[model samples]
Target: MLTIDTCSSADVDRLLGLADQFLDDWAEDAVQGGKPDEDYEQRSTEWKVIRPLLVSAPTMFKGLKEIARIRQSSSDPVAICCAALARTALDGFLIAEGT
Candidate 1:
């Protein structure tokens, strides 16, 4: 099992920020109504492959609860969006890292 204790709050926040950027870019691409940007396609492909595994993991609930807490505590829109993406990325990391 992955050790949630290994990650500090700042680290979690940083990861959230990056994930948010990814999501924002994806949204922008969708709004364009043209071909998806290469980066967005790559990230979306990665998400599709990893998402089902994450949902099946027993630790998902704890990660989700922690993300919800983070989201609720953040007043900034960017922070809230980031926190939501961090929820998925956290699970993805555990599976990808096999930790």
Candidate 2:
């Protein structure tokens, strides 16, 4: 991961912007009912895009631990769980990719 001292201002700005957009979109999805194909595509794209960014994030370790905890608590066939575990794993991958 690149330290703050090594990262350019533009990189930080871009990361923050992407994070903000992701959060906003996620929030919007929370209110919807059935999932759309585009939602899956967007999430996949997000995973691909953010994985590398997370490597440089300041809170990567904390985020990873949280993901681990969620995964550990998950039962078999993970999909049977409330989707929380899947979300957590997705989050972890995203962070790791960033690195």
Candidate 3:
């Protein structure tokens, strides 16, 4: 449910690439219980590798807003806009976790 207000097609591509990479890393970590660098304390604290992804959330939210506006002419504009907004909010946490 992630959307981005990308300035250009290149930004959209970059965002998707980053998302894919994050999912791959998360899947691998899940299979392994966690990353190799995860010590007891580190595991208990915040995950450091995901910091960059966290910073990208606002851009993604803006993107979703743009998408909702673009689709506003649909039969169910409210539903569509609400869905887009929901996706934007979820993307905040998902991107934060790099998932």
Candidate 4:
């Protein structure tokens, strides 16, 4: 697994933004059981942070009709996946950014 000596505030902040973006889109979709918009790229910085969240979000919200499910649940496999992805991002972002 990739690992980093430290995580930057920018990276962490971007990660949080990514997380929030997903939540916002998901909330919009939940309002009427509609699907989310899909105009985003797979290679952008937001996408880099949002990718893992998008990939695992379904599993994170499965069998639940409301976003409250996420708040009420104590354990979720998606959380584990996100944790792993966050670690990988911290370690790999430098390489990914060619720094």
Candidate 5:
């Protein structure tokens, strides 16, 4: 439920939290004996977690989609990568806003 109007530090925090959780799930999935809920893609921005962001944060969404396309085409998928993309998108938005 991340809309442009309601976007704030909380949104950023949510993004970071999602990133951290994905990282943990990835680690557990890799280490064995791990029962992580939902798969990797599910936890990404592509899912319901930030569905509104798709329109609310179109810039970030488009960038993420492009990266996803590129990575899926060529590149090893990383658990923390989505989070990094989110961070980068935020950075880019901030820079563009001049604030």
Candidate 6:
């Protein structure tokens, strides 16, 4: 996997693992007692850092939705689109930060 400057490999792995689990649970309802696991809790907490950004740049909301769609795909076409969306989202985030 391509590495980002801001995130360590461990972070990437944890995020991907959590996402994969969520996807699986979504399809089969494997989560016991219908309760979220620790991974889900961690992912939700991580959102707190960026939730403010979302409030500032409502336009990024669509980009985030597109990112979720992109995340589910394993196709080459989707990979290309994912790269574009990543750039757009990053740019939108930077702009929102006045950077």
Per-residue error (Å), model 5, residue 97: 10
Better of 2 and 6 by TM-score: 2
Give model 5's clash tally: 0
Q: Tens digits of per-residue lDDT for model 3 on 1-99?
A: 433333445565576577668656765765576445444335424434664555665676566666666666776767786767766776674686576
The sequence of per-residue lDDT tens digits that candidate 2 reaches over residues 3-89 is 433555566667777866876687577547565557656765787698666545545544545655666666756534635654565
* Clashes per model (N, Cα, C within 3 A): 0, 8, 2, 0, 0, 0
Off by over 4 Å in 1: 1-3, 34-99
Instruction: List per-prediction Cα lDDT, in the order shown.
Output: 0.66, 0.60, 0.59, 0.50, 0.59, 0.58
TM-score of each: 0.32, 0.29, 0.33, 0.30, 0.30, 0.27
Report RMSD (Å) for each prediction in the order shown.
13.9, 13.4, 10.4, 15.3, 15.6, 14.2
lDDT of 5 by residue, 5-52 (tens): 356655666776776676667767755746544555466434546545
Off by over 4 Å in 3: 1-46, 74-99
Top candidate, metric lDDT = 1
Better of 2 and 3 by lDDT: 2
Report the error of model 4 at residue 75, Å: 41
Candidate 3: clashing pairs of residues: 4-63, 5-63
Ranked candidates, highest lDDT first = 1, 2, 3, 5, 6, 4
lDDT of 4 at 78: 74
How high is the lDDT of residue 72 in model 3?
65
Candidate order by TM-score, highest to lowest? 3, 1, 4, 5, 2, 6
lDDT of 4 by residue, 1-99 (tens): 222324444455666687768866755655564553454332234656766764553344332323333434535777555555555554454586456
Stretches of candidate 6 off by over 4 Å are 1-5, 30-93, 96-99
Cα-based RMSD of candidate 5: 15.6
